[model samples]
Target: MTPAARTHRTAVLALHYQNDVLHAQGCIRVGLAEDDPARERVIAAAGQLIAGARQLDLPLIHIRIAFRADYADLIQNCQIFRQTAQLGAVKDGTWGAAFFSGLEPIEDREHEFVLRHHRTSGFIGTPLELLLRKLGTRHLIVAGVATHSVVEMTARHAADLGYEVTIAADACAAARAEVHKASLASMSLIAEVGSVASALASEKDSR
Candidate 1:
């Protein structure tokens, strides 16, 4: 991390399942696809450490999945909903259905909220933006798996909500690094993208 930024409030959201879950975790993983394994591992580690820091009294906001029984909306809006549900990709009331383990569940934590969504954006079909506003969060640092999907979606919503968003580029792993990069480039115009260390350093400097 550098020493160019101050410590700002951050919210970390885990994108998919991981080693904390069973082998059937989730389809989103690194190296196993067109993504870079090394980048994935690094981002995962950064997220883990950030979670730990948050747990240790550092300012951070955490978000996770809270599945609901109603997949009807998804069924109507998205065609893949039923198909992925059949594959048990994101089954309700299951461990794999929750957030990755490295991320501490915000369940009982302060300024924490769980958002259940049938789509990619956590803010979509959910009151994520409201919760963030209540938490007095002006800055959001996003880091998670599947850069092309969840990470991108959330960042876009954040921008629309007028939040200063920053994506931990290296802290995100995806099935396609190129696509992830493309998303990052687009997001940078709307938000900002940086490595975890660089971001942390920038945050520390801001403080």
Candidate 2:
């Protein structure tokens, strides 16, 4: 293990690693872990990040987006989600709603938990804050699909809530490279945006 993976107080927040978004047969996998070069980079980096976090003994929180079978909790106020409503995207208890096969937490890991959120920001409707507090998280390392959406929103919210945020650039993917890059640039103002290696360095360097 690297020195940084020895004694870090960081909590790794992995978002939207669901099969529906990452797998080849997933409902929206075209621009994610499938054919998109940008997203492919994110997936590769996320694999490394996950390995590093495990070695460092950091708390791992997997956040997924799931809605009720009846779609009662889905917000139809915007067109972006209207498609979800129509297609029944990520309905709970389905294979598509489960975490991607390779990314599920090991059963014996004590500090890891899977959570379901109904919105873009993981903290808005979830126990993420409480878990972080319990883990005494001083820095949050965020990685997930859809950099322009969930990843960016969560990082901003975490920073505003007084936690130092670190965006693992290569661990976040978007439908388009431009959108991904733009979101990262925008979030750099509020959080430290870098590759998985650089983000891990911060964890090692933190007091």
Candidate 3:
């Protein structure tokens, strides 16, 4: 990690790694093949980051998008929200809303938190910012699926909330390469875009 990260309270924010967003049969996996290398790469990179956070004793926060079975909490103000409601995706209590294989929170882990939201940004209608403040988290290391949406939105919001955000670039994916690249470019303006390894590196290693 960078010197700034070593001096500040930091946390890992893993967003939208649910089956409904990354699994083969997921409604949101449009334009991406089940065996897409990009998807696999993101899963692996994110897994590594999570493991690293656990070893470093950093808080691990898993954020997912889920709605009531009746879609009562879902707002259809955007195309993605409307599609989610139409496809009946990410309903609480369903397998699709579960975290992707090997990425789920460890049961009973004190530092691991799982939060559910109904919107694109994890902070929207959620206790994410409050939780971060309680944890004394000034620096955020983020990794997630759909780089162009949840990841981008959350990073931007975090920056605006006065948190130093670092996005694990390789740990995030989108339906298309161009979209992912564009989103990353946009986020670079407000956040540090780096690889998982760099984001998780210790200060000694950096030296």
Candidate 4:
């Protein structure tokens, strides 16, 4: 991790909304009810990252996708999920919109993350930057599923904003291994890509 990212409010994004929309098969699978093995693994990986980060006490946060009660707050702004809504997907308060379990989510607690609605890039519609700025976070370590989609897009935005970014390699996943590796390859020259252990191994190095 770059000096900027290692200390700058490192946040590991947790995963949800595992749709088959980008999968080999064109099926929008639901959560545990219609669990996808690949998606489960992705969630499991994210959970492990969250648990471990807690152990490490990294300045972390969590985010989940959602829509307002009227849903009017989103429809026009969202390009991707707007179409998804047409397909009977991602209702506002439904189970489908909830972040996958195993993230060690708190019922009611401090430092909890805010939920976003139809916002693809976590930083786009949310006050993530303001929150980070408040925390004095200029560097970010990002992790989650589907590196090509959400992960890649967010990383690009982070870099453009002059925030040093590192994507934990093993902490994220794509629909397929090829896509995952390809996304990392695309990011390697731009973003520091490595495992969570290797990313934080430097704390060990500093010792």
> What overall lDDT goes with each candidate model?
0.60, 0.82, 0.85, 0.62
lDDT of candidate model 3 versus the reference = 0.85
Off by over 4 Å in 1: 1-10, 17-36, 39-43, 52-59, 65-73, 79-83
Query: What's the number of clashes in each of the models?
Result: 11, 0, 1, 1
Ranking by lDDT: 3, 2, 4, 1
lDDT of 4 by residue, 1-207 (tens): 645533335654554433332232223442222345665555555666777666666556665555564566665556566655555555556655555545646635444465563565778877878877766766677886557767788788888888888887776776567878898999887799877777666533544
Model 4: how far residue 29 lies from native, Å:
4.7
List candidate 3 segments past 4 Å from native: 1-8, 202-207
Cα lDDT of model 2 by residue, 55-137, tens digit: 77788888999988899998888765787777667999999899887677775788778888888899988988887877777
Off by over 4 Å in 4: 1-9, 15-37, 68-71, 76-79, 107-109, 203-207
Q: Which of 2 and 4 is the better model by lDDT? A: 2
lDDT of 2: 0.82
Q: What is the lDDT of residue 126 in candidate 3?
A: 88
TM-score of each: 0.75, 0.89, 0.92, 0.75
Query: Residue 162: error of model 4 in Å?
Result: 1.5
- RMSD of candidate 2 to the truth, in angstroms, is 4.6
TM-score of 3: 0.92
